[model samples]
Target: MSDTTATPTRPVNWTAISITAAVVMGGILAALLAVAPRDDGGIAWFDPMIPGGWMAWTLPVAIFFWCIASLLVTFTILAIRFPETPRVGVLRIETTRGDRLFISLLGSAFICLVWLFFAGLPVWGALALCLVYAAAVFRWV
Candidate 1:
């Protein structure tokens, strides 16, 4: 008699997954930019709402690109160097990669909103806060 229990298997190659995710994110960004509406001045339609500064000229796109790039780099690094790092969950519950990503994105949005509501200009401050939030989420949720 043969016992039939399924055993879990690790992915054969995390590097490929990381590279694929980066390429897919880049493609999505490119597609969005390609179809996004522009104003007469060649700026994005939402440029007026974005804060102005040396690096804020292309605010939304810059932030979006930065976030994606950060995620890609982080995933690559984690996959290559810290594949065994344990992921913490919300309320001490077990969490997966998707959960952590969701928490990070949500935290970032909250940070941006709080910054917009209470503070103005120099979004770097908010970015710093968001980075801390992301770190906390990854570490403890």
Candidate 2:
């Protein structure tokens, strides 16, 4: 008699995931734009002022640009290909891949907000601070 347990292993297909997400989001946005009402001034109620004029086309174009930016960030993280090195940090907490990503993204948002609050300060400083914050997060969350 033999007893065996198989471990499940599924590799992430980022390309497929990205494509599916884009298609789904595009469909939803298209439906929204199609059903969107017009304002008294004849502009789309759902459309706001951006670099381009407010129209059905602009929403999808803006969404596409945003998706591109998101994909770039995701690809950059995938390119790093960091191993799941869960380690106890200064706070005595074990950090994993999701934890690191969350910490890094949160730190970045915090850094950007601080930079915006202090409008006249040098942005280089904020970038440096963000780097230090990321290092510290990876070291000791």
Candidate 3:
């Protein structure tokens, strides 16, 4: 004799994945389109990425914030679809996905700041270092 009750299978959540992809792609597109004014330097008419009051925000700054927003959206989706248990990493502390993400972001910021201090702008090198630091944080903390 078989049991009357049975568990249902979990199908892949393509909709969640699609929405996450759209957020990331749209962010990238916005980053690419973030341009300062061709002629006028004033904030009243130019800057697509930044608002009127924020004259200090440039393409790099806009892209950085956009990337952070995209990451938050992706992580939210992941947490909802696949819940995870906190795991101990090299830091000797238990960390959930969100915790790990926070650590990574914090470390990457310091890394970029240090790189900027030592070197100079055109921050490609700093970005590369940040990427590696972020990967290592995710892998081993």
User: Of the candidates shown, which would achieve the greatest lDDT relative to the real structure?
Assistant: 3
Name the best candidate (by TM-score).
3
Please write out the lDDT profile of model 3 over residues 49-88, one tens digit for every residue: 4456646666555656777877887888789878999999
Ranking by TM-score: 3, 1, 2
Comparing candidate 1 with candidate 2, which one achieves the higher lDDT?
A: 1
Stretches of candidate 1 exceeding 4 Å from the true structure: 1-59, 62-90
Sort by lDDT, top down from the best: 3, 1, 2
lDDT per residue (tens digit) for residues 45-129 in model 2 = 4465343645644554555555545645564555455556677777687877567767776877788788879864557787788
lDDT of 2 at 101: 61
Please, what is the TM-score per model? 0.50, 0.42, 0.71
